[model samples]
Target: MAIWNSRFKKSFDKSALKFSSSIDIDGKLFNEDIDGSKAHVKMLMKQKIVSTSDGNSILKALEEIRNEISNGKLKFDWQKEDIHSLIEERLVEKIGERGKRLHTARSRNDQIALDERLYLRNEIKNLLKLISDFQKVLQKCLDALPEQWNMCVKLKYLTEKSGEEICQELNIAPTNYWQIVHRAKLQLRNCVENNWFKN
Candidate 1:
């Protein structure tokens, strides 16, 4: 099964059309990727897997690489297997044996999973903030009208529509759509009832 899955793994066959070769698609995550490296380094230090000096050196090298990549001084090779391998290779070149120790006990699977979880956690927080801002906008729209003119039913309809729009925009799965909408509706209700627009 693993072999079959690997067979179907995605490939990047085309060169990045960005300014620099290294400024490719993966370059967009340079910050997050560096942050992940920092976290991994801290974990390695805590586990005593690598000495403090080595860890610090690895971090410094990563920062320099990040700056180089950011400034377009670095160029990515299309033939390289993947980003992690490419990074490991660069580290080895920069810091010798100590750089080689960075990947000890770490699997590509776990590394990719950690990076994805970190990204999704951040995305979810941003989405929640967007939802809150949307609710605030709706509350303001409600406040501009008199209390008697404040149509709960109209507001409810708009809220439902907004939820539907969000589900559609996010491509939310049918199974999860209702739950997400329910939560959004509850948030809208709270915003409306609390007179959140008073401020």
Candidate 2:
């Protein structure tokens, strides 16, 4: 049954339930949802909002649900309005009455926000990792260059020096400087394609 079922005189239409449901989309938020719930449950316990025993039961069941979802032993149902309701429904089934207490002090709406923020945080961390890996690959390509080419590339690109300035600093003719830069770029592109992008 839907959480708001009590307010209605008639049962919800199956098609409308399917139409209004976000389980297909927010089902991706299982990890964030479980993590946020676990933290919320702990906070409730600490503040004496729920008994420690009930909190422990809810936490244990939540981890079990997480593992079940991770191992594909559990499947999400489309009947639930969203991931929060689906998870809470599973929680209630696992631990009976105590699982209901897991929702204390916060609404499912709050869980939705928390899960989204956590998902974004995890995505940002992953993005940072990709950026870090790209920098490492660039450094490897840079390190493979001939010493003079490395210096010319760095002066021309890293320090934003003009072509004339880089040639003067490296004591190379302007024509030679351009050739060095061209070769360096080709090597960098080939190295990156072979080492990173090819895969």
Candidate 3:
């Protein structure tokens, strides 16, 4: 607040301050925010915008802040602006002058944007893993089917082929293709339900 007040004629209203605070909302983004800040520090050092020693100190203090937040030694105060300010404030407190350099080459909005992208990337990775696990379960069910049934399912669903193409590919008549597809459907459902749903 003191930093922000320097350019103002008078203090901002306290009620407006409470209304504008996003600390509680963005607190969950702490890990992403810390990660974004660390990356910023490294980039600044690489570009010579921030000295290596100063960046190192800021990084060290940020790591300490991360650990404290992780171990419940630090807590977010909703009265502050957001996680960016909170971390920056803590960093300045920890390493004094060096911590101020952490904000070089970035703004508060830039921090949240980077944090969100990193957070989304991590969540997307987790989603892909879950999809892979489900694919494994589905693969097991497909494997348990007869060879022709497996091929039928693969061509129709996995390969996104039409019934006519599938019949031509499998060298089966339309009636035979339908019969195999129906049986495959039943067997695959039973297999997945037995092996996947119960668990």
Candidate 4:
């Protein structure tokens, strides 16, 4: 296991000199990478490839490294080749001999591909939720305007414009527009509930 680890690390260090990482452009994969490592360690333990103690240690160390990177205590080392190498190097630094066991059965190729796919899957879910929320907010905004304002020629003109253009035309700051839109959505919900109960 140690020999395999040394060879892997050496290969990574050598490759680091040749390949520039996409992490600079797509660093959002950091969280997913960390999660993948956690799951991998669990699998390794289940297979008896690594001792439970070492597995737990690796998991804890990875979590600490993840938090450090996320909170800006650590910065990406672009010259370190890729995210997997960066993580492995950090683990070795943190856990000494035990860190060497973390990569027991995995190849860097599979590791990185898994991390990227998991990251993209999570990002898609988040984007879908955001779109749904935006639609709900838009519907609420439409329902909240007073009937006269809703039908007003000026309101129609503003609505037809892009949000940025509409905000600029109203002399409203972007933050103010967001706040108003959010509050209007909440009020619309309240109004609908009240009318439903009365009916």
Candidate 5:
């Protein structure tokens, strides 16, 4: 029986249940769900919505469940409609009545939204960091160029133009073009070795 089956007289049809299930879409939210539940339980305790003893038990069980999932000791059940239900079921199994109290103040909509926001906020932070690092590398590579060599390096590698194409674009003769390309390559190589790839 579902954790929410109390109001319904009969179980949902299997096909209907699968259609409404969010387990597949929200499966990646296991950790976020546990985190949100823990925060809710903590708030419940602070607000006296639930006793400290019950709150402590719920948090401990959640931590254990998180570890179990991380270590592959627990496998999520796809039959559960979503991570919220799966975790609530596990919590109840672990600490019985205390586990049921974790959801005291929040609806499923609020809980899921909080978890998703937390997850997306963390992901956005990581993406920003990656983009910042990439920008730094690009700056370092560009700064490595000698003032006069900068144009040649940018043309040859940054813009991905061949030596002959760069010469044509820059209106330089082949002889001078090859010389600039050679010096630019050497400068870029040393710069990368020093600024990026060195020990």
Candidate 6:
């Protein structure tokens, strides 16, 4: 029976367990789940909720589990329902009674939500780094061009200002604006082909 089965009179149906299980979706979040648990254990120690010796033991075991998973030495049992329960089970197996105290003031809903937020926070940091790198490349492309063409490219493509807005700001007519932008595009095309796509 699952860890929470004591609340029910009989064992839950296998089909119901399979249908309600979130292991498939939440398995990939193992790292986030472990990190959150580590934080929770530390807080429990701070508030005198769990003894320091137990907290230390839990942290040590969590680190071992993380390394085991990373090195392909650990395979989680998907039948456990979700990553949270899986980690808790493994922790208990490692440290006996201390593992049970890791969940003192936390709930499944809050744990899952915290893991998802941590995952998204990491993804956002990666995307921001990628954007910053692309911007540097774009600046290099613009800097290699003539002064007028560079300004037109920055205003039109980089700043994303409309033709009318750029023309008004640059004190140029609409027709003149299009002509400059057209020439700038052609120059950029050639520049990219020669510098970025050379055969």
Provide the overall lDDT of each model, using Cα atoms, as 2-decimal numbers.
0.65, 0.90, 0.86, 0.71, 0.81, 0.84
lDDT of 6 by residue, 1-199 (tens): 3657789998888888887788878888999999999999999999999899989999999999888878877776657887788878888888898888888999878888999999999989999997776666666777888887788778887686888898888888989888888888888778666655573
Candidate 3: lDDT over CA atoms? 0.86
lDDT of each residue in 1-199, candidate 3, tens digit only: 5336578898788888777888888888899999888988999989999888988988888899999999989888766678878888888899997888877778867887889998899989999998888889999988988999899988988787899999998899999999999999998888888877888
Higher-ranked by lDDT: 5 or 6: 6
Alpha-carbon shift of residue 33 in model 4 (angstroms): 0.9
Show pairs that collide, candidate 3: none
- The segments of candidate 1 whose C-alpha lies over 4 angstroms from its true place after superposition are 1-27, 75-77, 145-199
lDDT by residue (1-199, candidate 4, tens digit) is: 1124454534445454445455475466778788988898999999999999999999999999999888998787766556666777889999998997877788777777998799888889999997776666655655567643333324434567665775676767777666666655576667655544344
Please give the ranking of all candidate structures by TM-score, highest first, separated by commas: 2, 6, 5, 3, 4, 1
Per-candidate TM-score against the hidden true structure: 0.57, 0.75, 0.64, 0.60, 0.69, 0.70
C-alpha positional error of residue 196 in candidate 4 after TM-score superposition, expressed in Å: 26
- Please, what are the lDDT tens digits per residue for candidate 1 over residues 55-171? 999999999888877787866654443456567677878999898776677776777777677778898999999789877777675565444234432434656555455556556
**Which of the two candidates, 3 or 4, achieves a greater lDDT against the reference?**
3
Model 4: residues with Cα > 4 Å off, grouped in runs: 1-19, 141-199
The best candidate in terms of lDDT: 2
User: For residue 131, what is the lDDT in candidate 1?
Assistant: 86
lDDT of 2 at 95: 90
| Weakest 10 consecutive residues of candidate 4 by summed lDDT | 147-156
Which has the better TM-score: candidate 3, or candidate 6? 6
